[model samples]
Target: MDLDQLRTFDRIVRDQSFTKAAAYLNITQATASMRIRALEQLLGVTLFVRGRTVTLTDQGMTFLPYARRIIGTAQEGREALRRVERGRVSIASLRTLVSPLITESLIRFQEHYPSVDVVVREGRQGQIAAMLHEREVEMGILCWPNIDPLVVDLEPLVIMRERVPLVVAADVAARLSSRPEIAEVLALVPRVIALRWWQADPETAAALVRLAKTSVELPTGPARRLAIKGEGLGFFVNSAIADDVKAGRLVEIAPVDFEPLHRDTAMVVRSLAALERPMLADFIREIALECAKMGEIIDDRLDKVVPRKPWPKPAIPHP
Candidate 1:
């Protein structure tokens, strides 16, 4: 079917006047009439009544829905193809993963491909993996469950552990004459509960269950806010709350190591031969280089920080 004629027919139906349809289409009235006539002939039916006013005949009335649907589908097809050409890379990640590491890589990626549009969809670690597996997204950052399918390749980029610590408000941290140990803090303090999407994994979930107390479990942003406001201490990933720590709004209670959770994020994609075009392959290689640089940065930071050794603190009277 000639989409141009279908468009002409639809416009005539909308305007209810061949002259007006021609004006709207910016074509000569004769051309518009000829296109409409061709469409009607192709369907072997009269589409319009040529009276004082234009009105759809029975055939046109029946064909309206089909025409509209065809036009809509064609528009969507065009959009999808445009996305592919413009380097629209689809990615999913846990909200926590959008910290300095990932964003830094993205910045470099954008500089490399300014025309490429990036679509980032946030979900839990598992959800991100599922999107990659189903090919709903081009790539994703996921923890746990390794990529197993022969068609997909997983390139290990970096392993980062979020430092979950017991924190106190600035005022509260000052009140303590000495550093409080984890068990002591847990016993005396009505600590804020730390909730994270990363805790969905079995190992992390079990660790959180061990730390459960009379606590309010909230999402990462709100939970961090609640802790900052002096509403009891909670467990939080260091990367997620770096700004707060630097600004002195929150204090890390010493010796309360909740064990840094180690997770590896990799770039997963269909094998090189399977890629439809060079654009996607180019993106994958770019991402791999970015990931390597990110891993180096993370390693440098970790190397500088001295590891904390377990130390006992004097007991404080229960308030």
Candidate 2:
């Protein structure tokens, strides 16, 4: 019926004795009996057979799982609260958005506050937005600006943009002329398609995948893997394919107009959290410096893809 009652119920079943369960719960035996009775009355069925060795009735067996689930959820909530109280900062980032800049920022932050804990969750743009709204996380690193509508409650603390190079197989890379312009590459790969991951609108992505003559839209990792396998070409964040580029499996190329295809990503903070300027705020300068190092990437690809859609709307971040 309630968490306490369920806990008591579960304890009794596990311990196989009312007295033992009471002692485990640090309550009197009579109180444990009352709780079990109340639970049974509420359910209109007896849970355990009254005996030396306690046993569950048929209905009790069926109810155990549900009770355990509630207890587990309560325990998780308590743990999350404990972490937050202890000064742990939870941040969610799009999986592709793992740039070295963020990694460097984190390294600098840890050096200053080694005792503070940080939790990182990697997800899509929309999921990160939901986490920010729910207060499940205090900070979010995502592509584009998701806080426009929720502007009153959220603040765009840092915005980062970087050139995503077009990567191709070693053989394919050798054939293309050195430093081709955007129009030249498009002319060469007439079948290539574009993807906009900033807002992750299903309709926009669907159209890109639908209208494009070749090259299925892919997230960071798979796109790299496919390029390495000599399957196709893709635009990728530099950090994501550093190893492959160095190893000569993939070659990175830049077009004069490549910037138009990239998206902008931002680090957002809840306005209330900004006012508090919690531990994370201490590293703002470090993050900004890192962002500067990467340089700002503007001009959303959807505007390039849809042309009609507004610019600065949002990319696949990193691996």
Candidate 3:
């Protein structure tokens, strides 16, 4: 018999009245009677005796426990499905942002949600955007200033604004006098190590192209390593170079003519509603916290190398 028929039979036995059971089930009394009749017909046995006081037949007594077990098992199965759905979160991010930016946050998230299954995949922004659009991933972490039309449907939650700094080995810094002009420094160092496909900021791109006669293109990790060995100057996220700068392995170089380059890094989702899941929401929160700490590290490093200067006011400012 169907679940409804079995449930109706159990309710009738529990309540001891079809009328009361129907009221509790939010169905008419006649409907409840029909369900009981249908269940008895399926089993080819009488389930109840009708009189001034209704009572279970021998067959009904034999079947009550089985029917209860069936309903309970079905409920357990549904709950298991819900648990599976709630216990997993999937994310994709740019390969470069994962190390210094998300590594600690992911560790904290795993500690907090020990049972949750978190999968993080790394790719370029375009690849991650495609994953999000195709539903291969629920969320993504990408560098900002992205204008891909594929991400038009996604919702962005900015985690932090990252300073893009030009850094060199300690020896390179020592060669240039304190706070030297950008052009003078560029004249000395004619080659720069940079990412091959990073074109987020046109000003930074133009500056590097103008100063450096030769460009060494590599991935983030290798570029940093090569820059550390004094192969060439490096342009990198401030957080990525924070440890090296603090430890005197690298030094930040101040660009005189151009304003400091910055890019926003964000956690993006297919929809705002995806954050409603507790696991996803908690993970995003942890990322935000970690990014805040990264910002502090960048600021502390910048304070040491870049001099504090007030912004120049606009000549025409009435708006």
| Native-referenced Cα lDDT, model 2 | 0.68
> Regarding TM-score, does 1 or 3 come out ahead?
1
Q: For this target, which candidate reaches the highest lDDT against the unseen true structure? A: 3
Candidate 3 minimal-lDDT segment of 10 residues: 297-306
Report each candidate's C-alpha RMSD, comma-separated, in the order given. Answer: 13.1, 9.7, 16.6
- Give each model a TM-score: 0.64, 0.74, 0.63
Q: Count the backbone clashes (under 3 Å) in each candidate.
A: 2, 5, 0
Ranking by lDDT: 3, 2, 1
- Candidate 3 yields a Cα-based lDDT of 0.75
Which lDDT tens digits does candidate 2 get at residues 4-116?
79999999989999999999999999999999999999999999988879999999999999999999999999987887675676788877665665688878777656656
**lDDT (10s digit) by residue, model 1, range 1-319:** 6888888889988999989999998999999999988888888999999987999999889999999999989999999899877658776767776664456667755665667777778887657667766778876666533543433454433343344555667877876657455565555456547575343444544554466576666788778777778776765656666679889998876644444444455444433332444444444444455556434223222112222232223234479
What lDDT does model 1 reach? 0.64
TM-score of 1: 0.64
The better candidate by TM-score, 1 or 2, is 2
